[model samples]
Target: MDPLLSLFDPQVDSDSEDIIITETRSATLLSQNGSLPPECEEGNIEYKLKLINPSKTRFEHLVTQMKWRLREGHGEAIYEIGVEDKGLLIGLSQEEVNASLETLYLMADKLGATITILRERIITNDEDNCKARKYTDHRPHKCRKAVEVLVRKVPDDQQTIELRIAVLGNVETGKSTLLGVLTQGETDNGRGSARLNLFRHRHEIQTGRTSSISKEILGFDNKGVPITYNVCRTPEEICEMSSKLLTFIDLGGHQKYLKTTVFGLIAMHGHYAVLVISSIGGVFAGTAREHLGLALALEVPVIVVVNKIDITDNRSLTQTLIQLETLLKSPVCKKIPVRVETEDDVFTYASRLTTDHIIPIFTVSCVSGYGLNLLYKFLYVLPPSVSVNDRQRLIDSKVEFQIDETFQVPEVGLVVSGLLISGLIREGDYLKIGPFDCGLFSPVQVSSLQRHKVASRSVRAAESATLALMSYNNDIDLEKSVRKGMVLIEINDNSYGHKICQYFQARIHVLFHVSMLCPGFQTTIYIGNVRQTAVVVAIMGKKYVSTNESASVMFRFIKQPEYIKNGSRLLFREGPSKGIGHIVQVFPIITKTNDNSL
Candidate 1:
């Protein structure tokens, strides 16, 4: 097999190895005499054009300066790839280099520029270093450390390709269980025993769900390229690592856990998002509807995983598949059924199913370690280049939470437990929390944080984060500062928030048959996982609202919710059921169409 082909195959290598390129170039520019100078002369392109490390900030900075020189009539600067980090750094003419220095100074003030060797030399050594560094070995290359130089040509095309996959679904749908099977290998021993022990013995909580994200790594060879898969626990974690990786994010799918907002569905950012539907349940739940709405908004590619096939009846499985297909008819879902019976069966099924064009199914029990290979193969076979931007704003993004629990520790000072929809807080980071939205808020410090039972240094934008913090102001009112379902963050964006007596807008495709809709009826409004009893003060676009024909509506929340800020989001949880309709707006009834009385 060709060397390049082997690099792209996962079966070949386990780690990324640098691919080398060799090239020779002619000295096109003439000396003062209009002829090629002797090899000893520094003016000769043959001697001056050499490859330097690209990854080094110094190398990239030099290249950028060289481009500016070439643009300013410094003549062509040629180069070749030497070491992977040292691609090629071409030297520019003296006058051009001087001009490039001015542009560099301007960019440094706003976004902090890396301390480049060239910049360091220019700043410290000034004229002498510039003259000497430009010509010979007398002046060292502007670098943090001495660098080896290699004569080489830069490749015309340098492309960095990566894949991002997200897994999202309702709560208790075995989201984390399937993640264990897919990512488990000889190296993984499951979530750290130390963490599990803490929850079981210390917390006294019967059920432990994912609090913060977890991280794992999978390395294999694809063709000849060394393929490294960075596996993360949540969608936000995936984005943080997306800068340079083929990342796969495993999200927790639980209806009650889903924060339901643009911020809540953040884990959905990927080339494609895979929805895990349990065959154990046999039907789409409310959480499924929320996920579908976000998917529709983003117009992303959806792949459905029908997990736990070993326990589900074939008849129920078939029906579930049909229903999912019908609901997601736009791109149509690629279905993969998972059955776990034995460890050996894991890889056997993984390899077979992903090779086919259709969605492949493998039976594996995460507990017993089955069908793991099939999961890996399916992930490795995914196509490249997918974007999710258009439907990103389908629901409101800003939100606050109803504190299900809160307490204070002498070591930490204060610990707040609640759902988050809008603003993000990280460990050791400082935040302002209080009423009046102004000076009332005292800066609070977060230290030693725990999410879902997993202790994390920090937490992202999520409905879950059982936070432990220390506030500077002890006199501050903890109760009044954070109201249940109150606005935790007043988002800067005017377009977000719960609009009362306002039309609640949403995108409802023909796939979703109307189950129930109460116009001008009293129902509880839940925003950012905070449940509050509020009447549906009014409904707009009557013709479209009732027919389920209109895509958006304005819902006037009966009372001005405490924490709900402008552009914040809310969902309708009818009667005793835990979850229900999506809310796009909540505001005062100013229009004549207002029907429901306060």
Candidate 2:
């Protein structure tokens, strides 16, 4: 992590939009203001003085370099033309820039990639204002410009680059409204008119509160244009036209819906968490902070959004920002906060998210659409935190799909929706579903699957989808047998990861609790898509553990056995008490009525 700043940058205390790139490293926003930062030794970002023309050998080498950069970025990279290797912004003339762009186009085309001109800035130079004015010529020219372009090439195996971001904040923080505006290509009416498009239930529409997990996507095509234009009016159209997809897992923000929120966090396979804060109230005294903590504990990268700026007064807005800055600097989060206001801020800060502990703070209003373009551009270029290698490894590993939500559509029959944690699933592939209440696995086949509301023949790891299932034996009721938190795994004669466990041991740290936590303390446990109540049957080598204390504890699922894998991270909570840990050991199956102690 970059060294933490002792305090929030004083320049940010004002109500003016922040233009910070927290890291003083390459491509720092401040450096770009007067001079380009020194070229970075590594990363997908590259600097070029000008590529107007090159020899065949040099062109081939440049193409190879571009290929490496695309791989490093997992499909996308930034090329800063008219910038020198020594951090000088000695821009190029228009003709040179045109030729350079033509060369870039050829380079991208040669590598089967596409290019999008991100932005171009004309650099001004006044000899009269120079320190060496006496030695300067009579005329000053400002025709040169610095251009930034995005080059993208999706890997051969993937159709679209998908990134899931869980939207979390207190109720009325504009989570739903924000998504509605971004996906619907319309601003709110100050009365949250845009939000109406996202509500799934009557109560949500009437009360303006979300009680369930709703999803909406914002997509970008290979040319980096948002697919929300009038022509692409439907999800299917957006999916069909997009090369990159951003799935916003809109979660409930009320305290009562915390479980739903937590489930969404774990089950959605989120690559990042967008913590939306209301500018009027800052981080709500309760749910918002809790959501941020949950995201950090889960190790998910977070981006902050302070919404409703259109309604907030300057004084209050400043105060809220200061508070957030202070809280993020605290030991609990230890995050470097970057304030984003422009397109430059977006690229500089967003490109470095996965490499550092920096968190970019975006202030926007759904009503006025303030600062929204920056946010949209940021999401467009935001890289997935999961590396291509790791995702590929999971896709090749044993098949494991988690069940979080299930539906029974009229013509589709029984449909199960959740994330495919690993491996692949194809239509008609035989798979084992569940460690039913009886603690055993059953055989089932995938009738069909859908991705992004479009029927698809197959699904891959790290992708969320709805799978229609068919059980040939009919020994178990499809509607009654399948439940949330169950597994759908590849059929194996040995039957691994298909059995349930009644008790397991874990190393846990208590986050908060009034009194010492003793054996028999029970709480709701959430691991992946699994949610169940468990009791601490025993504390290893210790009788009691209090707040901030760590201990190895044995837990028994109070209701029924659950399919828990070893080394899986988990979160447990009850009332004001909470803890996070991982399953260190999963014991063999024990019947629900078993009373034998370990």
Candidate 3:
């Protein structure tokens, strides 16, 4: 028997001087020279975790639980390593690793064993590889981006922190009214909201409507929860800003901006989203569909604020709440909280009304200043923390500069103008161009970076930067590689693109119908720079879209093209018409049956 396996045996005497080797089905425990054997160590380190049970858990969950236990000073616990798949692999920091060890001690106690960890000395002769490895662990995952924007760590007791709130919703959904009412004393009637503190102060702040789409710091809590907010208009803007940990994202209420709204909800990855449904507008109409879609897509906690209650007929607030409850109970937003609040003082009174677990609803007249206090209080109570991490979810902080116009500078060969989706990109950063084709070498060093066409020192993620990248002497296919809708990302070590048809499947929401026979027909696709014609081998949907229905369709591309990673904007064009439908699934193919693939 392996020396490590013998230590874990139940029959092994606890007082044995020689290393007691014991084996359980999955894990082998040993106490020899204060370190376990290499294979056993590898087994524990490479253990696949499940989410359902404590024993069977994912890496991130296990690490998190371990950290918590260690912080509480409990050592020695045993966890059954579960299987890992689909973005469940979590890379922990040094601090997190230490915390896990502490928790592992707790596991040891639970399982009646004393365990110790031995550091693996990784000696490397290559300088670049070592640097890349060091940075890679600190940086986002190889494939996805790390969460760049973090909530400024605050003391547990402090309730208020400076927060930047972006007012978002469909057009004419009282978005402007809400902003105007909140900034009545400060903002002019025609002007929109830029920055106004809902918290009372002596003098009003003259905040100009932000001229750019990039996130701007609005204010901070006296204790410093930096409130930086930006209003999103385009899909690029939504994608960029939502990648950060913005305190409050107020979506635009304009119906035309549905795409922006959807992207914001998904990208922001908010733990809690405030869905403002106008009471006068009823529950299920134009903007309601849009809001409902967001509520469905993201299973985050939602607070539905029913605006314009004052304008409604004799129907009491209670009746409207009941109406909202009925709709929210649907799969989209279940157990939504509704509240009817009249106008009151901004600070003292507003914070009192924002409680209620499932869905906190507030009925306020943005025009009449009614229920404004309640909104403030609710905003105050929001959890100021971000989710696991953007990189863990395969989200990258990118800047998609719409090639609005380009020009050549004397010093720099070619200068491209566009908005950064996310991440602060400066000069000399090695950019991965169109997959790993050239191996992340052709560096697009920033000769000059600008915002609103004006030059600036550094450009932040989700902001617009008119950057002048040092062009390669040899003219690469810049047209196809760097064109409209092309994204720029700083490549991480694990950032390898995959061209797989069976990429952990999921149901898709396909729009724009061309032919009924198109269901099972395979066709060519051009996603980013990838051009592959795959067979529309299988369609995974029973319900057909009478008008617009979401279904999962499977395709087997002719030649699997690299750079066509999951969620790489799939543009399916039938025959000559280039793009017929958009591709949303890139993470995993959720459901599948045998014999479906060719």
Q: Which of the numbered candidates is closest to the native, going by highest lDDT?
A: 2
* Model 3, runs deviating above 4 Å: 1-170, 180-217, 223-257, 267-272, 309-319, 330-332, 338-357, 385-427, 435-442, 447-468, 473-485, 490-537, 540-552, 555-598
Model 2 segments more than 4 A misplaced: 1-26, 29-42, 83-91, 121-145, 229-231, 493-499, 590-598
RMSD over all Cα atoms, model 2: 5.6
| Candidate 1 ranges beyond 4 A from true positions | 1-176, 180-274, 278-301, 310-363, 377-410, 416-430, 435-443, 446-467, 472-475, 479-520, 526-531, 540-544, 551-570, 575-598
Q: Report the error of model 1 at residue 353, Å.
A: 17
- For residues 193-303, write the lDDT of model 3, one tens digit per residue: 323433122222232221111232223332222233234333233223321222345454544444444444443334455566667666544555445444533344555
TM-score of each: 0.43, 0.88, 0.46
Can you list the residue pairs that collide in candidate 2? none
Mark the 10 consecutive residues where model 2 has the least summed lDDT: 1-10
Per-residue error (Å), model 1, residue 137: 43
Give per-residue CA lDDT, model 2, range 421-464, as digits (tens).
Answer: 99999999998887777776777889989988888988988899
